[model samples]
Target: MVAFPDPNHAVRIAANELRIAWRTLRGKSTAQLASVGIVVVFGAAFTAAAAYGAYLGGRGLAENPGELSQLVSLVPAGLATITLFMAAYLTVVQLGDIDVRDGYLTTVPARDVVGGLLLSGYVRAAGLFTAPLLVASAAFAVGAGSPLAFPLAALAVLALTATAFLVGFPIGVGIAYLASRSAIVARFKTLIGAAAFLAYFGLIVSGTFDEAIDPILGVAQASPVSWYADLAVLAVVPSASAAKAGVVLAGSVVLGAGGVLASVRLSERRWYTESVEASERETDSVSSGRLDRLVGRRPAWVARKSWLRARRAPIKLVFVAYPAFLLVTPVQASVEAGHVTSSLPPSIALYGAWMTGAAFTLNPLGDEGAVLPVTAISGISGRDFVGGLVVASAVFGVPLTVAVAGGLAVLSPLPPVALACTVVAAAVLPVLAAALAAGVGTTYPKYDATSISRSREVVVPSMWAFGVYTLAFLLTAGIATAVQVPAAAGALANLLGVADAAVHVGALAVGVLLAGILATVSVRIAVRAFDDYTA
Candidate 1:
């Protein structure tokens, strides 16, 4: 009979994996490292403050055990639900993206690789809480006058977190399993995934997540997971059920072992399964046909190529969603109020133009990927190349922006003059935005692909490019919008301590002057950069 893979071997592999991850973080850019450091520092500080608050609260509630018990009992189920959701989401996004997976599985056991990945995910997710949780546990022991409570509570927390990962990882694997076998899923997965994210984001932004989560919490409380609360409070509370605590301990061990086996089995099935490939051929006829006659050959070819790539893999343009998040509050407020706000039209116009440029022209060189060498050598002039990107973005973005802005303006309370101004701004801003983005993109080109999912990588604009483009676009868009919209012009006048009429006239002149200079300089720079770009 074959012996099962050695548990110690799995433990060793997990330790090494964690070690490598830690080391790899050191190679990140200074800005990236600084950002990570800031996040970690804030997270640790927040948790420490929360632990102190919990200690103080525990001391007060110690005198009245019934009220404290009722509140504390709900903690287990809430925490478990949150942990399970987070772990499962991370696993789903990162399951099969393991580096050199085939080599690892061939050298070691498949179960061991699964074990290592599970441990890695758990540490990445829950490691920050270990110290703070221990401190809180000790504080509870002191408040309740039971020294044994600290160890028991800590142990309970550890077991619950472990079991949550054990169960959650398999659930993620099960999702990957279904996604792998279903062609329909393979075809529309991005749209479905985007819808789910937007729906969840809407709930949060609308402050209705609590309403949605209460039912889930109710189910968790009625399930066996509620045993964790009994185990946690067994030593601290005089009325805590010892029998339930015993059951939780035994159940945790069983679940943990079973979860490992399930993860191994599910991972094997998921990793080995031949994923369903969409058999549909891309129809290039539409993109190539009319566009060629409308524009000359070189520009048309470039525009068609850019449009085709975007249609095939829209995930690369996902960075454009960042602007949408900023607009959600205004849009949500308008939805609730049953009418468009004065602010919504301008906001939509500005961000719509921003999204238009970012969707395509934001990474001219790097976006070409393997074809960069061929594209660089192809007899395409810089003017034709940059003009093509401008044309592609403008073709789609301009009409959409004008339609959205004009449609909203009709529904809004803006004066006819302001409505006309808004439409003009919508039409003009996108073309300039695209030019600015192309220049910024070439200056800070990033060639590496960022992982969007387990099986897909997208070459989005670099952070430096994104930051620079945002600054330029906002400056340009703000000036242009202020000159066009009377309300905005009035606001600028107030901020600058100037007359409204003077601000409006000055803004118009400055806006036009800046737009002309920016458009001219950016287009020239982009053309030069594209012409000089070498693979």
Candidate 2:
């Protein structure tokens, strides 16, 4: 017998969910909250300063009303751009909050769950966003010397911000839905999300978004969006037309408010009716023969399976996050200045090595999943399993590091000897990273497949393992950096009272020797751990 779902209780459920999300936010670590608060405060201050500047510029151009039209457009352009970014960020955050923690959602009607979650997320986001917008607008008005313009301008800003955010909500929800259900998208969604986020920051930092407003101003001149700006400007300059404000307010309420409500309603239905899990549509077609011929069958099978799992669900590549961090400088520089510095090569090479360590070696036991007991019983020796992982990491990490380092070396302004050292570090460092990954990760294997975005059953390395690996990687990277960069090498040689050539040689030798020794020791640890595990 099917029980019909009741949605009369949606608001009640949504209220409860909101309370829970509030508590979750409240329960966050002090450092985490402090960091977030600092970012918000900084952003608010910047916005306020910019708003004050715009007001000053507008006031300066008041004598030429025709010229002031471009200034009028800046008001909406600034607010709308910020609002869009905030909306996307909030949407991504909200999408991540979805849970399959329980099947109660199955019985309670999907609409109620979606409605409750959406409403809760929306309210929380609105509360967090509204304060900053209001604060910046109020600061602008005070600086404009028009305290009376505060109420009307603040009201219009709030309305437009809300409308823009609400409109963005559906777009985010749609992307999240596709990610959850489509295997192909689910595989690359993390990369896509990262790209989109970085691109936005890139455009903003480069002042490209500001330049984009010139063409857009033409379209917005007589639009309601422009009137929204007019209403904001009127708050500063009382001489500006108030009739534009009235029409905008009325139109915003009628159209924007209606759209916001309808979007939520439709999103609820769409999310509920269409929700599905992402699952593989095709299985791996890898043959074990080639690997079996190269290594033993057992080790080859394990390696093959590991590669397949990663290929099928690439979100499991959490270790890549370390390498990605190293890219921030180069990416930001390229976006801002249209080029990367010569110094980026060593950093990039070191990061490649770090990725190798952080990759496949972690969570060997946990990664076995339901097959752990069977695989253990089959008695695949610890050395072979660990050895297989090292081989797996080397296959990709080694070439990746060497190729990238060599390529970047061509672009570097380093002395020839330094370039040679860079190439050496790139070659040997990844192998060392792979070796350490096996031992440390085996010692602190993570089995509980925690949620990363929407991908399920994705096992990652334990925090302990990651910390130790990162510490070693950083030390090694520092050494590599010192040896591979001409300035750093010369300084180190002077400080250590050694020839520059000798210092470079010694550093490279030490890095390779250190990595090899650790990898050897780490692989042994992995073997011991693997042998000791009983099903």
Candidate 3:
């Protein structure tokens, strides 16, 4: 029953796939097209700048073959690591173009499908960088005063890219094969992916990524991967050996061919195998619990629904994690020194409160999706619906903010009195922030769904809502922070021509009172808007 792969058919399939991608690009929205244009322009500009820089460096180093040789050797190692890692990463994430998976797999041989998909991916990647890379190679060749260097360097880079992608793609496919068959991987794939990403992110933020890079580079340089350098600079660099160039060129072809064969086999296995199914299931219906009785059943149910959805599709709330990057510099500084700084506490409080509102409270109307009409006319008051969102955000945000901010404040040089105030503000600000966001979200809602994944789509909150809510949070949180920092408070006092004590006590009291007033007004507005919603 096994069918032989037709290379001609695979070529046609890849061409068709590329045509479809081009059509899709042409049909994108104006904003999407503009973003793509911006990226291409930036890429082209960066490429030109890099090529010019390389030309200058190459010309200078032409008289210093020893230095140039060492630099050239190191470049290929780093480049190999990057190319291999990126190719594997792209393959792992995409799992092949999903649109081609169905009809193509059923109609064509698995080998042909895999071949076409790989070709398509290669073409797409090459389309972006091939011209720029060739330009850079030519510049380097001219600067080095070797006419033969241009073709050699281009060959090395192109061969290296092709070989690395071929090798990496199979590794990714192998990983996919394991994931499809493994029950444990199926159950906790998301958590595993998140942990890997977080670990990688932590390394970069801590400026310790070199700890990871050093070993990879050392191993790569010691291996045949370093042979590419010989091919690249064979004519210009005295250290470049003809024998090594021959070995690398020959090895790359063998490896690339073997990788293609392995990929076809692996893809066939993976495509034919039934994927492991997750057994965990949620309850069929939402019911109000004892806590729900105290908080009103309708709002409680709504809150419960929101929590379930968040758990099921955590990507929808990925925006909440964006603020974590803001803490990197301050946290890194604190790590270098001994203790947290005064700045860290306020940053935590402000950004933490911002994260709270952004998590679940924003986009009240849009988040409801197809159920908007049903939910709007379900006889539940706007008070219940809006209250549910506020509760959902505050319950999680308040405790977390208090724990993080209070913990950091305890480690800082802040006085006991100020620490207490900080903790109190941390706990209270998130609640007010949630209410503020709910109000702004309802006033300026967005209902258009944006795709987050192949199968999942979500309606993100409007930029107007984000802008207005950020401004409101900054005002409220800024005043609270200023009151706590003596220098800031003194500045505020001098600006307003008030005494230090009045600035510390009176201003904070007034800020809290104003924040409370605003939160109340915003909540009422949100409730009214939700109640009157026709869509």
Tens-digit lDDT string for candidate 1 (1-535)? 2223467776777788778667757765666688889988988887778677667656665666552354576777887887788777778877423677888888887887887787777887666665567677777777767777778888888888888878888888888788889999888887887899789778866668899999999888778777776776776566677788898889889988888788888888877878888666676667577877877789988887887788679778777886687877877777678788666777777887888888778888888888888887899999989889988898999999999987997898766666666777788888888888888888888888865654577788888989998898888676766554566777887999987667655664465567657767878888898888765
lDDT leader: 3
Clashing residue pairs for model 2? none
Ranking by TM-score: 3, 1, 2
Per-residue lDDT for 233-271 in model 3, tens only? 887778778899999999999998888888888878888
lDDT of 2: 0.68
**TM-score, candidate number 1:** 0.89
Q: What stretches of model 1 exceed 4 Å from their correct place?
A: 1-5, 67-70, 128-131, 142-145, 311-313, 450-458, 482-513
Error of 1 at 210 (Å): 2.5
User: lDDT (CA) for every model shown?
Assistant: 0.77, 0.68, 0.78
At residue 85, candidate 1 shows an lDDT of 82
The C-alpha TM-scores of every prediction are 0.89, 0.77, 0.90
Give candidate 3 regions above 4 Å deviation.
Answer: 1-6, 19-38, 95-97, 125-131, 281-288, 482-518
Most TM-score-accurate candidate = 3
- How does candidate 1 score on lDDT? 0.77
Q: In candidate 1, how many Å is residue 240 off?
A: 2.0
Which of the predicted structures, 2 or 3, would earn the higher TM-score when compared with the native? 3
